[model samples]
Target: MAQTGWDDGQALIPPDMYTDWTAVALLLLTAAPLAIVVGTAGFFIWKQKRSSQR
Candidate 1:
């Protein structure tokens, strides 16, 4: 049977998972603002082209 005591070296098990919530939140926040700006600029450019074509 396997040992079941603190001195058995079980504490050496590596962590199975890790999460960086702050980095995720920062990426999401930055992407949203950049997307909004790019979308708005694209819309204006399309409108100007349509008007110029008339």
Candidate 2:
């Protein structure tokens, strides 16, 4: 069989699937840190209250 250009199979991804996801990506990036900070602060506050009650 003669070699076709597609034999290498380079163009797998469709163009529309390439739409900008930077905002969504950034939201995820920031949300993780924010959640961590809030969770840590809440845990400390809870620990303080629990110790005070003893």
Most lDDT-accurate candidate: 1
- Model 2: ten consecutive residues of lowest lDDT: 11-20
* Candidate 1: residue 3 Cα off by (Å): 17
lDDT of 1 by residue, 1-54 (tens): 774554466766445546789999999999999999999999999999999999
Residue pairs clashing, model 2: none
How far residue 28's Cα lies from its native spot in candidate 2, in Å, is 0.6
How do the residues 1-54 of candidate 2 rate in per-residue lDDT, one tens digit apiece?
786545567757644466569988999999999999999999999999999999
TM-score of each: 0.68, 0.62
lDDT (Cα atoms) of all candidates against the true structure? 0.85, 0.84
In model 1, what lDDT does residue 43 have? 100
- What lDDT, from 0 to 1, does candidate 2 have? 0.84
